[model samples]
Target: MDITEFEDLIDRLGEDLSLWPEDRRSSAEELLGHSADARALLESAHALRNALATPPVRAPAGLADRIVAAAKRRADPAEPHAEGETAGN
Candidate 1:
């Protein structure tokens, strides 16, 4: 497989070479062995996978509501400015 296809396969199937299809595994291994760039790509993919698998940090309870309110204010062009703010000021 070309580098783009190889990268896409790892991204779709994840970081485990063993989980790659039987026919593709040998060629992928050879590429990994010979190409520094391919090896780096595999390592980067594994790092991303590990990062995603980490437990998420919890946000403060009201954070979601605050975020939604801010988004709504931004989305609504007619939303009123807070006190003391002028149209062009």
Candidate 2:
């Protein structure tokens, strides 16, 4: 199979060659044996699949509360300043 066909198969069947239909999997393997570009494409597809499968990183605990508190302090005109400080000081 050609590179375009191989790419289309990757898109449809994902990076797992074992999950592909028999004929397509054989064709993809044949192409991979002879073509560096096809191997690279398959590797890249695997990397992308792995990246997508990874769980997202979460914010630290109390981060939302800290952000909200900062916003409220900025928004409230009457919020207390440090001791001995005046407005616009």
Candidate 3:
């Protein structure tokens, strides 16, 4: 698989296992026949996908900080801040 395949799989990730076809699974199994690392990576991705569907017991508080940072970067600085005229204007 290439970047497009990975990107597509990521897009339809939630409950869309069809991205990984059964035939391809057999191929993967064959490819990883003796490679533990490959098998572990595949298992890890599967577990992560499964875990994504579960609701968090506690909401992440850092989201507000992240949103603020994103907004600051995206926000126009209140009419470009006139020279010597404070934002209070």
Tens digits of per-residue lDDT, candidate 2, 1-89, equal: 89999999899889999999999999999999999999999999989989999999999999999788667766775997556655555
lDDT of each: 0.83, 0.89, 0.57
- Sort all candidates by lDDT, best to worst: 2, 1, 3
Give the per-residue lDDT of model 1 (tens digit) for 1-89. Answer: 66887898897887799998987888889888788889999999989989999999999999999788767766775888656754553
In model 1, where do residues sit more than 4 Å from their true spots?
Answer: 60-89
Better of 2 and 3 by TM-score: 2
Instruction: Flag regions of model 2 displaced more than 4 Å.
Output: 81-89
Q: Is candidate 1 or candidate 2 better by TM-score?
A: 2
Query: How many residue pairs clash in all the candidates, one count each?
Result: 0, 0, 0
lDDT string, candidate 3, 1-89, tens digits? 43334444444553234556787545554655766765555566778878986987885889888677556644655445535645454
- Looking at candidate 1, the ten consecutive residues that score lowest on lDDT are 80-89
Of 1 and 3, the candidate ranking higher by TM-score: 1
